[model samples]
Target: MMQKEWTTCFPFLNQMPDDERRRFLQSAVPHQLYAGEVVVREHSKCVGVVFVLSGELKVYKVSESGREVALYSVFPGEAALLTVNCMVAQETPVADVSLAAMQESLIAIIPSSAFFYLYSVSPQLQQFIFSCMYKKFNAIIDLVEKMTFKNVSERLYEYIRENTGSGRIPLYTTHAQLAARLGTSREVVTRCLKKMQRAGFLQTERGKISLLEKPEP
Candidate 1:
């Protein structure tokens, strides 16, 4: 990516001191990730600070049964902060914590050594990193709360409602994929979806689920 394009994704670079910004941009490595590619594997050493320029990245964990449970997604203008903790500590992640491209994506990475240097000297970089990390942390916390306190059916309803936003909306994900995102089995998701369908809440077709009407209180 051109320097201009990179700057456009991370506008905070404009606020950084010239020398610091220059060093950071000079060290960054851009990579193109294809859909379904696993960019970072579980229990590995930190890759670096990943900057998503476009498309999406999914952060997930693999259970012993080989089921993948999604933690969250990183989109354009966002960074996957899970790596930040590992990067700063110079240690492998404690959890399975893996990252995969949810779709074709462009990402720029600052190597761990360069990141530490830039983070120390550039307050703007520090602020930007921490701000992103804080937001992602809050999202993870909310996900945890829901997973712990809500049943699969309730979570499924909320997921559909939240994604629907307003009006009938089509979601382009398979039952297995929704199961992964909601930390459940495909059969469970399918049953819950069938129940919802019977209740006039949604309609399911191959590779798609569409909201039909809002659930009553």
Candidate 2:
């Protein structure tokens, strides 16, 4: 891959000096992941800073009951916050949540040491890293707030709408995936979805959910 062409799509790296950018590009290791592949597991050390060049991943936590709860979805141009934490701390950061590829993905993996070196020398990069930390922290806070206040049905609606927006119907996801995102059981999510379908709000088929009514954000 051409270094200049690849980094052009990434906003954070675009602000670096040419020499720094070249060095950083040289250090990156590209990785490809198929859907359902585990990117990182809970309590395991992060291998490197992962920058998603394309496709999606879900960051989530699993309870003792083996129920999975999604924390967030990471898209292209975003890096894992745990990786950044590891870079800043100069130690292998143990993950509290798991991450898995939601779709086939292209990712650029930068060693923590190389990232830290750039962070120290580039003020712009330092600020960008700090900004990433702030945004991810806020995202976690938002997730907590939503889960605490929102009912299962409402949360399911939000999740569907988030993925599909108002235009598309029949989002490609399983009931188990929806349950994970909503922090509920698959049975509960199925029940809620059925209710919505009956109420003319949505429809569910095998491996898909379609909105019958456009939901508010």
Point to the candidate with the largest TM-score: 1
Instruction: Encode model 2's per-residue lDDT on 1-217: one tens digit a residue.
Output: 5865566657667778988988888988998999989988888887678878889888888999899998888777677776666445545467767888999998888887787787789886777667767777888898898889988887788878877875375699888988887788999988888888877788777887777765454
How much lDDT does candidate 2 score?
A: 0.80
Give the CA lDDT, 0 to 100, for residue 14 in model 2.
79
Question: Per-residue CA lDDT of candidate 1, range 1-217, in tens?
Answer: 7778877888898898788888988988999999999878888777688889999999999988999899899988888776776776645443258999988999888888898888888888888887887878887898999999999999998898777774366788889889999999999999999999999888889988888876685
Against the true structure, candidate 2 reaches a TM-score of 0.90
TM-score of every model?
0.92, 0.90
Q: Measured by C-alpha RMSD in angstroms, how accurate is candidate 1? A: 1.9
Q: For all candidates, what are the clash counts? A: 0, 1
RMSD of each: 1.9, 2.5
Runs off by more than 4 Å, candidate 2: 87-92, 214-217
What count of clashes does model 1 give? 0
- Give the per-residue Cα lDDT of candidate 2 at 10: 71
Query: Which 10-residue window in model 1 sums to the lowest lDDT?
Result: 87-96
